[model samples]
Target: MRRLRIEGYVIVSADGRLANVDNLMPDELKFEGDKKFFSAALDQADLILHGRNSYEDQPSSPKRNRIILTRKVGTIAPDPSNPKATLWNPAGASFEAACDHAGIGSGTVAVIGGPGVFGMFMDRYDTFWLSLAPRVRLPDGEPCFPGVPARSPQDVLAAHGLKPGEVQMLDPEEDISVTPFRRAAS
Candidate 1:
């Protein structure tokens, strides 16, 4: 059996917001270093899973196999907008099945998301790359994990048995940092 590792990638503000009030990621909230890190990670993944909203916002990348998670069943089909993408409903198809549908047999699977998508795979994440801009705070923004009662992203990851690793400074001037939390060894 091929063991598939699911990894989550997210960029949040100091306040744990993933997006602004409009449900859109603002320019000020974006950092070049974080973008490069995430893009490189995705480039190396065998499969990428995203929520419908995030999938729609992403530019088409034919080289990467992607699955867009949706709630509407019976809509499992190739995405019309992106040839390398598929619309999948987890309720009808398992994650393994979705990977098979995308022709991914093994290796890392990147889960890039909206809050629900991130929350859905919380328990399965082998590692979560959480990048944050300490100086940035979105008072009225969407959280990294919606409806999660945890006060902070760290608390949420800790609740899932992930232990925080060393923090890497992505942008010193901007005070942006990336932290990797790996599942504790059994």
Candidate 2:
């Protein structure tokens, strides 16, 4: 089976109340530290998966294949500048199949997103890489993961047959925080 990974950040309460997407991204997220790590991770991804709104933030010079999911956007035939970038519409079957059909068959599939995308693949994801910017607080911006009842990462993992992997302090110099969770070994 293909290895599917969901990697991104979300804000939640200690008891499990998650912030909504409409309040997630804001001027406060402009941390140089978080930016560095995010860029680094993007470089490491074999293919970057993103929703419509998230795709708008894509860097001009991407080092890996970029697979954008959208119901409205049609195929943007490959160009010299975007030889590996393509927009996919996951009509129904697993997004994994969409990725496969788009030639994103192996390596890490980074699911960078808007909340709906995350929620759609949450249960099927094999791993999750999360970044926590404990310092930046958005008073009225959008939330990270929205909709559905909020649940701690642990609870969500258990429900999806996933398990905690390792929590690391990324970019100690910049104080960027991150954690990685993998599906329980079978």
Candidate 3:
């Protein structure tokens, strides 16, 4: 069985503007603190899977193996302009199989969001790494994850049989939210 991980930052505001689809790095709120945590998490994963929108939002680089999921088939290479990232259209093997091929066996295979991608594999995702920024505020932007029936993370986790780990606060000054989850053993 392939391991799936869902991880992203979402702003819990009334308007849901803080978690914009346009912004690649929502945790970058004029502080290096959040960036540090994200960077650390990114390092744990050998491969990164993201939706087309999230992939396009990122600056092309060769630092890590990237998989962009889309509908088209026979597409496996990253953009010619940026050779670092790889594109994976639904082909002979499913996206999960492609991640296994990319050598994500035991290491973390992070599913960065575009909403649909997260929703598609929410049940299959083994771990959920979430960061809650406490102080900074965004009044206008798209949501972090969309299209799922409105429910608290706790509620969703209970439905999926996931449990939270011991709470670890990053910065008391920032009042940030740092949450992590893992699937409970069946």
Candidate 4:
């Protein structure tokens, strides 16, 4: 749409949860291998996009350019807390415009998530890395994407035209594996 390659990164529990009942990711769901893979992938992104509540604090966060989805902003505004961050409302402006405003002409855009954020870009992702923590389960917890359980993360991605790639096992003992779902070629 704007000469951009959009990709998503998320870790879900056995029941398709991104977080616990309290809307926070529990420590049990965190794994070292998934962390390393996610970090490396994020390092290569030209821009990072996520919802207001979905930030994962990392050492490179301050320096990384980010477009934060927020309902507080009428259009696009500078994020006072972070110089590298911009607050954007999709209701007020288009994604292409928001990217342009953020000085992101084109490159890889890493869409980190919360369910609401993930749902917004359903039809636009070029690839989405889905890391699964098979041993963990967050029953009645926050879903990885909207309509999860009823519609799995895989089903959601598939509906958005992305087909699953080969699954890569990140941790054998913990049964953690990641799948890169690429958009099916039209």
Candidate 5:
């Protein structure tokens, strides 16, 4: 059996928020270093999984295969705007099946998120690259993992059996650091 390694990438504020109350990630909150890191990671991945909102917010990339997660069953089909992307309803199809539908054999499957999507793959992610800007705190913002309630991102990852690796400072000027959390080996 071909084992698919699921990876996640997220950038959060010091208070563990992913976005502001307006559901928008402000430009000042975004670090260039994090963008470079994530872009390079995606460049090497065989497939990418994103929530519907995230997918719609960005311009489509025809070079990379992508699956946009949605709740609408029977909506699995090629995206009309992007030939390289597919709309997938995970409730109607398994992840493996979705990979097959996207013609992905085996490789890193990067899941870029908006809360619920991150929570959905909490148990399956082999590694989660959690980048944080400690100086920035969005008091009334959307959390990195919604429905998780009052827990730090580290606590949430730990609860799901992932051990945090050494923190790498991506940008000292911006006070942005990335901690990779990997599932403990059985």
Candidate 6:
């Protein structure tokens, strides 16, 4: 029941890790082609949602409209660091209300990563773009989603009612492929 559409985007390792144990995305996993696709997708979104740690702190981030998921806030608060960002607690306010408070009415919301933020939108994602680096392996690393390393990322998505579409190779030399999973129709 959100009025606005939600799409999740993430790139995982062969073993289904989003980042290494230290919560740092390894350089080996970054591919130019995959980055291009991810960037383009976010560029089209009306709003971007992600947790505090996931914020890149890039110079351009302040200009991008975003919601920073956090428990420190009781409900909704303007992010002190970024003029266009809002600190939101999902438990305190509904997604729509949060968007309304942020001045974004109806449009695509790109939900970016870090496990907790990604897992919170499991049942709500209209589409989840999963790009995998098949040759990269990071054992005992942070999972891309909940139940990941123990259970495959595909299993988690299927359980949440999302089905994968055709895989497109983003980088053949890097052996990276991206799959867009859509929620099944009722």
Say which candidate scores most in lDDT: 4
Q: Global lDDT of each model? A: 0.84, 0.58, 0.58, 0.91, 0.85, 0.88
lDDT of 5 by residue, 64-140 (tens): 89998877648477777778887898778787888888888799999998898999999999999999998988888
Among all windows of 10 consecutive residues in model 4, the one with the lowest summed lDDT is: 54-63
User: Candidate 2: where are CA atoms >4 Å away?
Assistant: 1-24, 56-61, 73-82, 92-97, 147-149, 152-158, 171-176
Q: After best superposition, candidate 4 residue 52: deviation in angstroms?
A: 0.7
Candidate 2 Cα lDDT to native = 0.58
Q: In model 4, what are the clashing residue pairs, if there are any?
A: none
lDDT of 4: 0.91
lDDT tens digits by residue: candidate 2, 55-85: 5354733557777677764433333446677
Order of models, best lDDT first: 4, 6, 5, 1, 2, 3
TM-scores of all models? 0.92, 0.70, 0.73, 0.97, 0.93, 0.94
Q: Which stretches of candidate 4 lie over 4 Å from their true place?
A: none
Q: Which candidate is the best by TM-score?
A: 4
Where is model 1 poorest over a 10-residue stretch in terms of lDDT?
54-63
In angstroms, give how far residue 62 of model 3 lies from its true place: 2.6
Error of 3 at 99 (Å): 2.2
> Higher-lDDT candidate among 4 and 6?
4
The CA lDDT at 20 in model 1 is 88
Question: Which runs in model 3 stand beyond 4 Å of their true positions?
Answer: 1-18, 21-31, 55-61, 72-78, 90-93, 100-106, 135-140, 147-149
lDDT of 4 at 173: 88
Per-residue lDDT tens digits of candidate 4, residues 77-178? 999998888899999999888888889988999999888889999899999999999888999899998889998889989988999999999988899999
TM-score, cand. 2: 0.70
TM-score (C-alpha, index-matched) for candidate 1: 0.92
The digit string of per-residue lDDT tens for model 3 on 1-186 reads 544554543323333333544554455443455556666666666677777776423232357777777766474545454445556776545766666546555556667766666656667667676556645455545555553236554456556666787766666677755666677766
The alpha-carbon root-mean-square deviation between model 4 and the true structure, to one decimal in Å, is 1.1
